[model samples]
Target: MSETADSLIEVLREQCLIQGQNGIKGLSVVFRAMDIDYSKRIVYEELKIALEKFGLLMSENYLRTLFNALDLNDSGGIDFCEFMHKLRPSLKQCRIDVINEAFEKLDVNKDEAIMIDDLQVIYSTNAKQHPKFISGEWTEEQVLRNFLDSIDTPGNPDGKVTREEFMNYYAGVSVTVDDDSYFDLMMRACYGLPIRGS
Candidate 1:
């Protein structure tokens, strides 16, 4: 293997040890599955199939963007190292992107802020229906209170959540969750899978 490839494999081995066997085994399975032609690298079409298997169901344009981001050497395909790296920190960012997209959707009035009424409507209408992972283990009231505390400062007591505040709250929560479970949640989010218990 090339030095880069060797380095990438080492990283994957280390991550597997840290994340435990199941996590590493899942990644290995996905990687092998994506290497549909057994070429030891994943091409764009193969990647699309793999993501679909994970329930990502992303648009072609979005997939292209993601593929390009991970194809670091401009190699037209992603090797194991690139794939592992992408699945690591980049997957976390993908989860954040998912959160940001949902937040934008919840900003019903396009006012760049989510009002209490907007939140209430969302919670009432879709919270139970979707049961998003971000809701965590909190009751609706607890989730609402936590969100309010994050955004409603002394100066801004009007019960409105700005995009920044919303993102910050989630980013903070991601770090605070139990390490193993947090990564599991992030992995599920990355794959567009519904998290258990929401």
Candidate 2:
């Protein structure tokens, strides 16, 4: 296998392990029932497709539901506070993109934009709310703390998570996202649904 493919597999496996899905023997049992081969990428594609069938992509109902919740004034266009308020997530994605945008906004250093040190205690603040991952559970909090440490560092000597650096390592900037849509990456990955195409 190519190194890239192996890397992806390793990351996927680690994510499963970290998320408590790794040792979920029930996962194997369930896969067996579905006649799925866990070692196969096609299986992941199949699973992802199945999840899409269950609503991975945003339905009109989902958008309207979330939109109504955010439109506090009942007027079109989400205001600054309302935008931040509606941006929070009940669940956490082990990835970093939403936070990346937040960093872009808070990036005081125009030189490198946002650095890891720029982000601390990512709970609800007056300016922003993190929706992808709730700062919940002991390990989850640890993950946040570790993530902060991972990204924060001096520019030249220590070197931290610069906006560019963060995008390269964790955030996928090359993947142009859709604006009129409301869908999660986890759903996309698990279901192999192209954000734009299908």
- The TM-score leader among the candidates is 1
lDDT of 2 by residue, 110-139 (tens): 556443334333322411333334444334
Worst 10 residues of 1 by lDDT: 149-158
TM-score of each: 0.35, 0.24
Mark the regions of model 1 whose C-alpha exceeds 4 Å error after superposition. 1-27, 90-198
Clashing pairs in 2: 48-190, 48-191, 88-131, 89-131, 92-132, 92-133
Question: Across residues 20-114, which tens digit of lDDT does each residue of candidate 1 receive?
Answer: 43344355467676675667688898878866664446667666766776688989998765665444332265556656776776676789888
Report the CA-based lDDT of candidate 1 relative to the real structure. 0.58
lDDT of each: 0.58, 0.37
Which candidate should be chosen as best, given lDDT against the real structure?
1
Please give the distance, in angstroms, between residue 76's alpha carbon in candidate 2 and its true position after superposition. 56
TM-score of 2: 0.24
lDDT for 14 in candidate 2 is 38
Clash count for each candidate, listed in order shown? 0, 6
